[model samples]
Target: MFLRAKVRKKDGKEHRYFSVVENRRIGPKQQKRMAQRTVLYLGEINDGQEAAWRKSLEVFDESCQRYSTLSLFPEDREIPAEASSSIQVKLSEMELRRPRMFGNCWLGCELWRQLGLQAFWEEKLSSQVQRETVPWEKVLRLLVVNRLIEPGSEFRLHRQWFDPTAMAELLETDFAVAEKDRLYRCLDRILEHKQALFVHLRQRWQDLFAAPFDVLLYDLTSTYIEGEGEQIPQARYGYSRDQRFDCKQVVIALVITPEGFPLAYEVMDGNTSDKTT
Candidate 1:
């Protein structure tokens, strides 16, 4: 049994009451939590024992835990000039799971925040009624970050990559329930803002790096797709960077600063000549 105090201020005066509590389990059978079970309610303290009781109870409550943390200093050990002064260590009994690259997501999210991409999307993609738990902007950001870091398909992200990622928590949504079609729709929706995005990114790039645009380093590349799909209008027989000239491909034109920060890009038909694009 230990003392538990409750203090309330009423009309510029403090009223204090104490309780004798016992430890008990509260939550569900599978997820139990420690709670104080009140054994007796003691009236407001009018004596000196109140402070003493409070201090003792505080120590008792703190020590009633499952884990033990210890710090040790050896009396015979001498402090070496090159060695560290103190060594702090931690130990955990719980099994660690769901490991993901937190730093990668953090960097991606920070970049997005600095560029004001989230706010810009929210403003542009505003709707009359948003019933879904996750917003379109958030979904887009998740896909963008995933592409930048992991580089995978929507199916791969939804089925495999997303659950282990910090993206769900960072995007403020349940990613497991996020359908792949919604991601595709997000891609379609954001295409309308392509020009706007380029303009926004250009301003942010200049502001951040103060990079001069007097001269730009332009480049061209082509990615080959193995499947010959009837629906893909851009896919045609072209010179493939992957040495798969037999497969259909699409061409990409990129403009970057001397520092290699991309300022603009263009997607051309696979048959489009390098000089023509």
Candidate 2:
């Protein structure tokens, strides 16, 4: 049992009220409190009047739960008409895919063939010896055919072979860690055949651009080489085109048509003067 009492002054008079709470549960079933409040004001406060006011309040609460249109409404309302959307959002179904390289399928194939890709691989590249070799096809496709891509990007595209499923799907080959070392060795073979490699590439460029060539523009530029230095004569330091004067540079001479179709290219000593040629 519990008791609560309150004293309040109205207009200049004081009045007192009391309430009691009785615990109704006797066993482990459950327990709850029943409460009733009494007051001394006979003029306004009575049991019947308070019961009527409470019933009205209860009806207002039910109406707000049932028929209220606007979210904020008067005290008499019951229900709210507005409800939020309960639709579940769907995820995108797109699969992981490679980027598109060329649009016209036949034209792309013709252009690749005109680049002497097949002959360069089977004839010239096959004729050379490698200290350790991987699929020569893979290396040639990367360095020779896809030479348009930067060297840093080559490793990214090449690493697709590191996944067994991706390797089987793309190349129809089961790749392993052992194959990666062989791939590196085959790429090294490209340096040994650089002269012939560039010569063949220059020939292909000439054939592709010969019909369209009129005015040719030539410029000399240099790129900084990374890692251990090679004994190549052309890899030296002078005026660094890439602004890497602190490091030895690889000088390249690029020849292009007025329209910007590349025709020929040559590498020479970085210290060589462009004005002399």
Candidate 3:
């Protein structure tokens, strides 16, 4: 069994929830074990109940309060320190209380806001053509860059940012829940525009490192998705890199220079041999 809890607080209210799910174990002992996850909804509680949950959560709250969250906030250009301190502290407290050490959407939004995305967002909104603004792109780019910097399951990506209302508010957008299909679509778009994406990345790299890319390295990866579709030029069955040949997958080549600058990428049928090039 697994337990899950959600806590929410809003309009001076608190709500608490607890749930459990069961799973089978296949380890050396091969026995069943209980898995528990909990979410607390502190937002629905009245003042009195809120106080009680706060009191009940005193240990965690204190851990948050005692943390020096000021250092975590980004330094904005020419902004008065006092002006941004409160927001920074609140964001820090939220981060400190998190159960894991992955990308925190609230923190990411706070940092992006401090980096002047808000002004860019407003500017783009006012444009006649409404061209894509640098800030919006930066935010998305940062999110993707973080993924490449530290790859993790899409579930983790969803869990870390998909449902955080405050984070959406900070980003001046809605928290459109990042479903797997949506994520795949976004990634596919990126792949379609891979050349332009690499050009932008290369420019940023040159500016940051004052160098150019050399000695491109290449490798391929495969992942089998659910369901069977007609094999395309880039889809086939082969040595399942994931050790599951029952399904067909596409092999995607990821190329990077010796200096770690990405050069190019391509996709082919899973049966396509990495040994080919």
- Pick the lDDT winner: 1
Model 2, 1-277: lDDT tens digits are: 2333467898999865544323343434465444343312224445666554333223223645652222121234334445242222222333646644342333433455678765665565665535324456545453333344333344544574233223332333444322545555666656666567556766776776654545779998888766546766677878886777888877789887677766567778878887976
lDDT of each: 0.75, 0.52, 0.52
- Model 1: residues with Cα > 4 Å off, grouped in runs: 1-93, 128-132
The C-alpha local distance difference test score for the whole of candidate 2 amounts to 0.52
Worst 10-residue stretch by lDDT in candidate 2?
67-76
Candidate with top TM-score is 1
Deviation in Å, model 2, residue 81 alpha carbon? 50
Model 2 segments more than 4 A misplaced: 1-111, 128-134, 144-184, 187-210, 226-233
> Model 2, 8: alpha-carbon shift in Å?
76
For residue 76, what is the lDDT in candidate 3? 50
Estimated TM-score per prediction? 0.64, 0.46, 0.45
Ten residues in a row with the worst lDDT in model 1? 66-75
Alpha-carbon RMSD of each model: 18.0, 23.7, 17.5
